[model samples]
Target: MNPPDNPSANRWLVTACLAQVQAMRYTPAGLPALDMVLEHESQQHEGGGERLARASIKAVAFGPLAERLARQALGSCWNFRGFLAAGRGGKGLVFHIQDMQNT
Candidate 1:
């Protein structure tokens, strides 16, 4: 099956919240490398502090509005450490860049 086109075309693409992410297991999509950080907060909470979770996901910037999408993905204190390709030939997992900085 063909993967969905315009994955980043939506002005607001719905994604799993941090809490939801924490509850699930996500394999990184590619080799653990530092491409960029994509972060975002939970809309469930009206302008409140963003809940911590796997909000960031390693992605390629070959798409349109790559920078904006990455910025939107990494919402607040969220950080991007590197990338890791998913075992299933999908996408890589995103690491929290803040983890390194906080140390």
Candidate 2:
């Protein structure tokens, strides 16, 4: 089935810590790109019980955001605003970060 055309349909926001960051790379079109992983941990109520939630997700940022993220300290937490898209080779989801703010 075709996906919805609404721009907000793919929006994603998460609070996480920077886990890993690869060296800055330039796309063929000369845009700065940076790939990284974000780790999140929290306690949530599930099934009427408290549970610890954790996740490590792959993400990417381009242009100025890429340059800014590349300079952030590892393990620092931030509120990430972005959208999800297929990863390389359609393997898995990759978060396309649009903005970030201190958490």
lDDT of 2 by residue, 1-103 (tens): 8879886998999999999999999999999999999999999999999999999999999999999999999999999999999999999999999999999
**lDDT per model vs. reference:** 0.34, 0.97
Best by TM-score: 2
TM-score of each: 0.25, 0.95
Least lDDT summed over 10 consecutive residues: which range in candidate 2? Answer: 1-10
Number of backbone collisions per candidate: 24, 0
**Residue 66, candidate 1: how far off, in angstroms?**
6.3
At residue 72, give the lDDT of candidate 2: 95
